[model samples]
Target: MKRKIAPFILIALSLIIAVGLSACSESGRNVEEIRIGVTGPLTGATANSGVASKQGMELAVDEWNEKGGIEVEGNKLPIKMYFEDNQGKPDQGVSTAEKLFNNEEVDFLIGDAFASSVTMAIMDLAGQYEKPILSGEPVSSAISDKITENPDKYKYFWKGNVGSDAYGDSVYQTVKMLEESGDFQPTDKTVSFVVEDTDYGRSNADEVARLLENDGWKVVAYETVEVGHTEFYPQLTKLGSLKPDLLVSVFTADSSGVALVKQINETKLKTLHTAVYYPTRPEFIENAKDSSEGLVWIPLMFEPLLRESQVDFATAIKEKWNVVATPNHALGYDTMNNALTSIAEAQSLDSEKIVEQLAKLDRDGILGRFVFDDSNHTIKAGPEYIPVPAVQIQDGKNAIIWPENISTSKYQK
Candidate 1:
């Protein structure tokens, strides 16, 4: 009878061991299951930019996860991202944020490539949920500062790119450098700024105006009109009277750029200087045909070989994507990388700690040495413009005309 009781006790102990082993297996799985959330205009007017950004994010994540993800303490984890299409609408973006915060339970967040207005709608939500949001492409200065205004409500958001005001400041530097180099007369001071009637346009126009005034330059004219104004001749007529030495037009897409250049060429403004954003693209030059000649634009970044590292990166990215990578792609890559690195450093799934680590980063990644300012979560990498050479359309090609080292093909004058 004693032997029978001893056998029953051994069977019970075996069952308990089995249950404990199963629990351990479920609780200690690999860290690759970390989830990140991403939102963007994947199916709307800004779809091209969205697609490029998505690709950059996926590329970085794929590479990182392949390397066993980032190391936290003694364990390596894997990262998985869940992306939602915002359709480039504020309402859609808000819905996506809701899903990410409530249902998906993502460890981190990214994007809203347009501006602060789009980011603002979802920033508070991220903060309320205590989830870190590493911005992908919004350039407005307010994206970061808004958080500082309401620290309790927006403590989890951080910027991983430059602000919109930086571009205007860079343009100012370009103008000053050109004048000092004797490329233009110091009296070539009359400047005209024409912007489309949009939030981005308004902010850009104001910044440019303020910058020019601060620099003691004569602002010949400052104007804003609806984006789809096909006929720019009326405005061109007014600008012509101002006798501006420089014409700075910020238009979007191929159609608007072509229309602007056609109006400029037909009006015969004889301004001797013209600069525009969309017109700098290859498609814009092709659409403008001969009218694109002699247009000087300042690009935030370009794909041409300005330096060894840049040339290599541009060639590699272009070969992979079959098109030039815009600054949007750079922002996307940096944002995702920063978010993932923050996750590794935090060593926990808590968003509050991740945000803190991101704000303290001093690492140099694809977008160069960058660190988000603690005061406002703004990334400061110094004002480094790509120095968009004075490229002119000549003999069926856009050729550079400034800085002897980068002048590959001279303009056919």
Candidate 2:
């Protein structure tokens, strides 16, 4: 569904345009390059995510530059990147955004941290400063809810990803389908959750739990841990004791995900295991290998083994960066491409035109089609827009198992 922009959102758009005009860089100036400031955890626990995002952004930049750059006012302006390391800290994210605005004077910004805490920290900079921001990851529903609740406050912000609820829906439907197909049977209708202690983690955990509870499943245990906390033994031990039929883990760190898999095996927590976010990274399989066998996860977008388009994008990324591409890389690539497409379509740096063009965009990327729900300035999720399929790691490869029409393999446990 498309968003019906309220009057306040229009007013907010006007404010963004007015601010953009006063900012000079987004106005009639001798602009040689489109300065884009990028934020990612380039040097912390999630450095792999940061690096992948950087590579994706670079790929997008190369594509636009190869096309002779974005034409505006008879001048082709190339994109120049100003990437900063947030280290996955909220404070660092805020400070990094400030630096980008004050020092680089970037015409646009992209957030790649994929964490709600970090995205929320830097969201206001779009309005407070004179630029518009688009984010690729960070799936917490709270971000969209906030924009919906206070449109005027977030008028200059846009999210290129679907909300956390999509993850919940994917996991819930996966479990339900597995049961319906007689591939999964439970002694008791019980579910457990272990997630990072952040909005993204807690939000996904609560959403999936809510769906299962509504379906008559009892909640056995709900555990939260700090980001990068690898000590799942305590939580795994508790889960083993309870023996919930399903255990869902949500985290963003590669180490945390790999550690969870290894420890779950060590603890022999036999409950059917599912996950969100982390397992999509290639390092998870490289690091976890056999331990991740039969693990079901959601939201597979850029698995090279899944689609020819995926393989094409992964091949380009490998040729460019010498590293295997992950779903996060696809997200970052699509996010940047969406921004550039809108900017070029607008033909001017006017925030009003760019934002309008963005809301009307209907394009395809490595993930799937890109269409925003104008109601809340977030991407639509599902089969028709973006398919959020459930996947299982079998023999160190991605085997899509749920959403049967797109399933390449059946669920094996």
Local distance difference test, each candidate: 0.68, 0.86
- Candidate 2 Cα deviation (angstroms), residue 215: 1.3
Give lDDT tens digits, candidate 2, residues 81-172. Answer: 88899998888989988888877877788864456788988888878975778887888888899899988888788888999889999999
- Per-residue lDDT tens digits for candidate 1, residues 1-413, read 99989988999998999898778644544445788888887875456667777777777788798797876665677788888889766778888988876677677888565444567677777666777887776656667668668767777888766665665665665566566667666455778877766555556556666787787777878777655456788889998787787777765444667888888889998664545446545567677887877666544344444434556545556776777866556657767887887887888777777877887787665556667777777776353322334455555455555544556654342
Those runs of model 2 whose alpha carbons end farther than 4 Å from true positions after fitting are: 1-30
Model 1 residue 179 distance off true place after TM-score fit, in angstroms? 3.1
**After best superposition, candidate 2 residue 83: deviation in angstroms?**
0.6
The per-residue C-alpha lDDT of model 2 at residue 74 equals 67
- Model 2: weakest 10-residue lDDT segment is 22-31
What's model 1's overall lDDT? 0.68
Q: Which stretches of candidate 1 lie over 4 Å from their true place?
A: 1-32, 71-75, 185-190, 217-221, 225-231, 251-255, 272-290, 302-304, 315-322, 383-413
Q: Which candidate gets the maximum lDDT versus the true structure?
A: 2
